[model samples]
Target: MNPALQGLLTIIIGVGGCVGYFYFSNQFLDKVLFPASGPNAGKNINRANIIRPWLFLLPALLALGVYLAYPVVETLRLSLTERLPDGGSAFVGLDNYEQMLDEPKFWEALKNNMLWLLIVPALSTAFGLLAAQLSDRVFWGNLAKSLIFMPMAISFVGAAVIWKLVYDARPIDQDQIGVLNALYIFFGGDSPNNWLTIPFWNNILLMIVLVWIQTGFAMVILSAALRGIPEETVEAAIIDGASPFQVFFKIKVPQIMGTIVVVWTTITITVLKVFDIVFAMTNGQWETQVLANYMYDKLFRSHDWGVGSASAMIIMLLVMPILIWNVYNARKEMQ
Candidate 1:
C-alpha cells in the first residue's frame, strides 16, 4: 500500500472510531442505563455526568499504561531476574544489583556520571546566561546567538564526529591535521596528544560536547526569561546607584532564578542519560563511561540482561527525583 494512503486511512479510522464510540456510549447511557425520561432519572443523569470525564480519559489512560507504565514494570521485573541459558528467566532477587556494585567498571561509570551531572548542566547554564546577557548588548546579537545556537541543531553523534576530528591525533613526524595538535606544535610542543585517550581529562573533553549542544537551549530559555523581566526593576536598581553587575545579579537573576533552575534540571536530566557522545567518541573506553552507555554495554555487548536492567533502574532512580522536582516547581508556578 502507498504510505500516504495508509496514513490517510489510519486517520479516518481513528477519528471515526472515536466519534462512533463517544456517540454510542452517550446514547447507551441516556437511553438504556440512565433512561432520562424515566423514574430516578435525575440520579442516573448525575451518575452519568460524573462518569463522562473518565470515559473520555479512558483511552489516554490505557495508552499511558501500555506505553509508559508497562516498560517500567517490565524493566523492574527484568532487573530482578537472571536470564537463564534455556531462554527462561529465573528470579535472582538483588543478585544483579549486588554484582553491579561489586564491579569496578560500574563504580567508574557512576563516578563519571556524577561528574557529568555536576559539570554539564552548570557549565551549560552559566555559558547560556552569559551569552544571553552579552548578546543583547551587541549590535549583531541575533547573528551571534544564531552562531552559538548552531551546535544545538547538530545531532549528538554528528557533533561527536565533528569534535573527533578536532581532537584527532597524527604522529609527530607527519603533518598534523587535528586542530589541537596543530596548535600544540605551533606553540613548540614536542608530540601530538591523543586528547580523548587521557583518563580524567578525557571525561571533561567528552562533556564539553554536551555542554556545547545544551548551552544554546539554556540561552534561548534564559533569554526569554530575561526579556520578561520588568524594566522598572532594572531601572530602579540603576537609579539607586547599583552598578551593571549589581543590577544583573541582584535584580534580574533573582527574578529569573526559577527559569534558571528549570533549565539546569532540564540539562541535568539530559546529562544523566548521556550516551551518544560517549558511545561515538570513546565507546566508554578511556574511563569516560556514563550510565547510559554502561547500561547499553551490559545489555547488548555482554548480553547480560539482569545486570543491564539494574543499571537502567539506577539511571531511572537518579533521574526521577529531578523529574519530580521539575514538575513540582512547574505546578507551584501555575498555582
Candidate 2:
C-alpha cells in the first residue's frame, strides 16, 4: 500500500467515524431517549441540552483516561511488583522503592535534579527578565528578542549537540575547534579541557544548555507580561522621583510577579523532567545523573522495571506540588 494513500484513508475513516458516531448518538438521544413528540418533550429537551456538552467531551475524556491515566496506574502497579524467572511477577510492596533509595546512583541523580531545580529556573527566569527589559529599551528590540528567543525552537537534543561542539576538546598540538577551548587557548591556557567531565562543574555546564533553551521561553512570556504593565504606573513612579531601577524593581516587577512565578514553575517542571541533554552530552557520567535519565538507565539498560517505575513515581511526586501550585495560580488569575 502507498504510504500517502494509507494516511489519507486513515484520516478519511477517522473523520467519517467521528461524524457518524456523533450523528447517530444525537439521533438516539433526541428520538429514542428524549422523543420531542411526547408529553414530557420540554423536560426531555432540557435534559438532552444538559447532556450535549458531555457528549462532545466524552471522546477527550476517554482519551485522557486511556492515554494519560492508564500509564500512571500501570507504572504504579509495575513499581509495586517484582519480575519472576518464569515470566510472572510477585507483589513486593515498597521493596523497589527501598532498593532505589539505597542505591548511590539514585541519590546522585536526585541531588543533580535538585541542583537543576535550584539553578536552571532561577537563571533562566532572571536572564529572561533581564533580556526582556533590555530588549524593550533597544532600538532593534524585536530583532534582539528574535535572536535570544531562537533557541526555544531547537529541540533539547539538537541544542545539546550544538553546545557539545562548543564544549568539545582536542589535544594541545591540534587546532581547537570548540568555541570554549579556542578561547581558552587564545587566552594562553596550556591544554584543552573536556568541559563535560568535571563532575559538579559538568553538571553546571549541562544546565547551561537547558538554561539557554528555556531562557527564550521565559523571555517571550515575561516580555508579554512586562508589556502588559500599565504605563501610567511607570509614569507615576518616575514623576514621584523613583529612579529607573527603583521603578522597575518596585513597580514593574511587582506587577508581573504572578507571571514570574508561572514562568518559574513552568521551567521547574521542565527541569524535573530533564533527560535529553544529559543523555546526549554525558549519558549521566561524571556524577551528573538526573532522575529521568537514571530511570531510563534502570528501565532500559539494566532491565529493572520495578525500580525504574519507582523512580518514575518519585519524579511524578516531586513535580505534583509545583503543578498544583501552577494550576492554582492560573485559576486565581482567571477569577
Candidate 2 regions with alpha-carbon error over 4 angstroms: 1-5, 327-335
Error of 2 at 246 (Å): 1.0
All models, RMSD in angstroms = 2.9, 1.8
TM-score of each candidate structure, all chains considered together: 0.88, 0.94
- CA lDDT scores, all candidates in order: 0.93, 0.95
Model 2 lDDT on a 0 to 1 scale: 0.95
Q: Clash number for model 1?
A: 0
lDDT of 2 by residue, 1-335 (tens): 99999999999999998898899888989898988777998999999999888888888899999999999999999999999999999999999999999999999999999999999999999999999999999899999999999999999999999999999999999998899999999998989999899889999999999999999999999999999998999999999999999998999999999899889988999999999999999999999999999999998999999999999999999988986887887799899
Candidate 2's clash total is: 0
- Compose the digit string of candidate 1's lDDT tens values, residues 1-335: 99999999999999999899888888887788777667788898898898888878888899999998998999999999998889988999999999999999999999999999999999999999999999999999999999999998999999999989989999888998889889989999889999999999999999999999999999999999999999999999999999999998999999999899989988998898899999999999999888999999998899999999999999999988987887887799899
